[model samples]
Target: MDSQADLADILAGEPERIATGFQFTEGPVWHSDGYLLFSDIPANRIVKWTPDGKTETFREPSGNSNGLTYDRAGRLIACEHGNRRVSRTEPDGTITVLAERYNEKRLNSPNDVVVKSDGSIYFTDPPYGVSEAERELDFQGVYRIAPDGTLTLLIDDFDRPNGLAFSPDEKSLYIDDTAHRHVRAFDVLEDGTLANGRILVDMAIDAQGSPDGMKVDTAGNLYVTGAGGTWVVSPSGEHLGTIVTAELPANCAFGDSDNKTLYITARTSVYRVRLKIEGMKTF
Candidate 1:
């Protein structure tokens, strides 16, 4: 996926603006219900947009949510920045708090999340959502929530960890540090712990944007929000180029019936483009 032809093949057509008039937007997730759900952070709402151009509020006062994804059971798991916790929306429409504190200390802020096949949840906690005086934890950390509700701290050395994703085979985890402007890959052990951490990509010091949200395709190509636009890179960290958008994109996800549409959550609006490649299936 390093060649220009490969990049061109994934871009099906010009990116079209599907919705606008939002304050800061992030966390775009594709649902099987024929709609794309995203977070309007400043508005404190989650908005749903359909392919036919219909947009509506899915949830209001959304805890100032920033990142979202569906678990294997098709439940919506969200990273609530305002509430400083990770939550899951149940089938009965009730919200369940998954993780809020560790070692009796409140989390700084839950920023992004991803679930593993074994029913384990992984997320990044940074201090972006809260002020220094209001924070309880002294360091930013990456954590995992087990199926039995046990919370474990994976890594706590990051300056500001933001986005995270698993490899196509689920044998590796990739997490990006916003303050450092680099992405790191970690080996996923049998017990769901991370090890053998290494730098996968460095978004040059002079780059246009810092590292934020990210996703991977079925072929293992990483699409990360950084610098100027969405940076498309190979699994080994080769810079393939970027998918430019009108506004500075905050996050993105694969959507549509075939999972071939890349939905982007930019500063003020949500945009999308059809792609020839299919996104990695979580289920």
Candidate 2:
């Protein structure tokens, strides 16, 4: 367990500042092409950060892009909440809408997203971006956009499926239900459906606030963002410890030049810490 002193050092001290002057930020994705791409939600733009700490504009009026990931072809996939659809950023810089509706009814808002090795895009839909009465969908469900462009609902029972990530072996799926104040684990079936869901962690809503975004390390440890800080849960769901942050952390990713740095997005700043373990994904 990392002691309080160590946790303090991780949050405090000289931190890495990738850039500044952002209205609000979310959904950071590392591009091995030597740049980091993230959404400035309120600014309605996507910004890029070079390894040398230089900032540049990647896209304008990005349809309020939130979560992002690169497909097998290295094309950027984005969850556009404002547009109520998911899109792909092609190499030629053209945007392609992946999924926009279910059964002819418009989606609420696509929040966080993850891509399977098979090229399927899995994303969570919550009404956070839309007014309560404006949500056309009945429930905040998790949906999968198949490689062939078929939209399938994976599970529609979550109170609010906030952040999602697949297990190391892709046999299990973890989803954070902020309203429920717990993280649930489900069995990934052969056809990409989820079953046998059980609460993995019953967090105290008062202490931790609410679970937001998460990522799995190479060793299967789940690093989750919360109001208190970043909670590190062991593979078996043990509450290992928390990585304190200077401010309220909104989301986090495991990215660095060597892929061993834990990059955190606090309220208005981005910070990084060298980790003993590397993250599974490049970003």
Candidate 2 local lDDT, 19-48, one digit each (tens): 667876678777776667888877888888
Question: Relative to the true structure, how large is the alpha-carbon lDDT of every model?
Answer: 0.90, 0.78
Q: After best superposition, candidate 1 residue 107: deviation in angstroms?
A: 0.6
- The number of the candidate with the highest lDDT is 1
lDDT of 1 at 101: 94
Per-residue alpha-carbon lDDT of model 1 for 98-141, expressed as tens digits?
A: 99998999999899999998899999999999999999999999
**179 Cα displacement, candidate 1 (Å):** 0.5
* Per-model TM against the reference: 0.96, 0.92
Local error of candidate 1 at 129, Å?
A: 0.8
